[model samples]
Target: MEANYVSKTAKSMQLHRRAKQVLPAGVSYFIRYFKPYPFYVDWAKGSKIRDVDGNVYTDYWMGHYTHILGHSPSRIVKAVKEQIEHGTHYGVCHELEIALAEQVVKMVPSAEMVRFSNSGTEAAMYATRLARSYTGKNKIVKFEGGWHGGYDALHLAVKPPFELLESNGITDGALRDTIVAPFNNLQETKKRINDKEIAAVIVEPVIGAGGCIPAEKEFLKGLRELCHEKDAVLIFDEIITGFRLAPGGGQQYYGVIPDITILGKILGGGFPIGGVTGRRDIMERMDPLLYERPKFSFQGGTFTANPATLTAGLEMLRNLEDGRVINNLNRHGRRVYRGLEAVFERKKVDAVVNCVGSLFQVHFTREKVRDVNAAYRADKEKLAKYHSALMDNSVFFLPAKNGAISSAHSEEDLEKLILETERFVGESGY
Candidate 1:
């Protein structure tokens, strides 16, 4: 075991050192980097990923929660391959784009008209702009710890120290119109919305990056009512929850519809994509035909609704239409949640597992984690140690991030994960 660890460490360190010469912090994305460098995956199939050192792990990250069907599924791969043979891009409108848009409109409750973007950040940014245009208001109300994307407008208040900006280079003026509210606290959110200038209330059905804390049903209903009362667009940032919670995303699962919906992640079928859909009248403000009008909200992208991504996403949605995959993944997630809870109970570890649908997170605190602040208060050191130990046992989960269950995970994979988790609990002296 020691020899294997040394070998893995050697390969990862060598690659990380080479990466640092060109890439900042030796990684492309911030979350991909961690202490002692992150594992370099050679390839992944189904629920397993092999590192450069040839060590295999049962993967739970699932491409940052995007791979609901698992890594490099045959359906998506075949579609992409066929699409590439024809041509990857044409610089013109295609039939697949319309087909994909129709599927989204049919599935999502709020989707009457759909506009596509290349990433969740672009979709969310455009959603906010559409809301402002529709309401003729400037301020947007966002919950603390609810991450929309990396855009300047909605990037505030994603984590603790809520008063400060999440990233540098964001001016105070950029955040001047962004109002932060406490998640799950309907009263506090209502108070913040009292300002008549608020244009929208954007929230995550489940806090994905902040923590896998599901929003209360009552809270979501309250926001829907308040947005209608205030004439503000309520945007459900379902980038993480879309197609994972149900066929119509969070709105269908919770029976509370938002005025505007932001979707990405799973919709891409392991590719890059984002979509903004909402009421026809509101979405019409982005119509290129209305370019001469003052209310027009400009939204365009070079790679928006590309045929390759559309073909892959369409195939994924077709597979999900039967709902068996969704049910299986959610069941697997519940099993893991219950198993983890039992381990913590028997081991006397002061921990709580927050789960909703196929997403779950382990917090090293006894308190129920309903919001970002509660999650932040959990023991970070203990959680990291547990994650690292799990990694050592050939079980891979995103360190300090949530875990996602995919249809690719077989019963054997789940059983092994539970057994390994139990072993970690027994050996970890925390």
Candidate 2:
């Protein structure tokens, strides 16, 4: 048998065939591989997804850390459905927009005002512009593994193994204007500073895609102090962490506030939305009335602040009133983390896990994945084997180590993940 996933889904094969002929890389995203081909998803619901072949799985990818309250949550879905009935897009202001903005201000301690966009990239693109415009400076400093939504500057040296400096256009001067220091390297980050030319230091607080590594409290606090001392803005790109870590996201958890925060993912409850919000004075520039003309910031998209997204966002924000989502997520996350950790430890396997709040990553190294260097040092080959086996055993991850958590998952899901992982490690000869 060539795996149930491959043997079934005849229509999927045809669809992929047609898709590859027209679509770049056979899909819009690089992760949607068509070489070995990819499985098609029919639809999904709370805690479970059914692929084209009806392989029901307790999905943990959660739309790449986007679905905090779970897939098509009733509150979110109801909001969307009602809004959908009212002609999807309104290229103008709406009440939902105001509600969403107000909700963000109330929840995120750092955000006094929020301007919406359709994606985190846009939020980050504008955050960069705002940092430059506010400070009258041009340089942007980012951590080694911090991914701030894939514009030219922040995308550099993103996923390369720690030992290698693999990047493009991030030259010495490029890097000089855009400082790239190893995460958690307080001295290196300190050395990159001087007489206030660095416009901002942008980070994820807990770097999500970079193997779920959380900054040491000292490292984050140091960045805060250094940015303040250097007259630079400290920006937290909480696109993934916002509403996922806690009601206030990483800012509340870490207790180190940033000057500006870029948000996405959970804010829209799995819809395509993003926002950049901060101090009122800085955000007022986006107000057309202030300048007698509407000017575009990096976060501005034509679809930004439209009715449908605002509805979904407003509902999602409202759902956080109970604080139960974060609590459930953290509980499930801890269970999974501990279950996996115990398996590795009891078996004395050469593996490690990085966990914080409700997010985690299982690295196949005993060295501890504190930073990108250690994450790169982990046994990726074993991880691949483990990932494949877990899939075979009917659990779902991102098919990559860096993934998310959700309130929808249960301990049963964790057991499935752990048992499959242990079985793979013991049997796969790693």
Global lDDT of each model?
Answer: 0.88, 0.78
Candidate 2 regions exceeding 4 Å error are 1-4, 161-176, 194-196, 288-299
Q: Which tens-of-lDDT digit does each residue in 30-68 have in candidate 1?
A: 899877788789999999999888889989999989999
Pairs clashing within candidate 2 = none
Taking every candidate in turn, the Cα RMSD to the unseen true structure, in Å, is 1.4, 2.6
In model 1, which range of ten residues has the least summed lDDT? 1-10
Which one wins on TM-score? 1
Residue-pair clash count for candidate 2? 0
TM-score for all models, in order of appearance: 0.97, 0.93
Candidate 1 clashes: the total is 0
Candidate 1 residue pairs that clash:
none
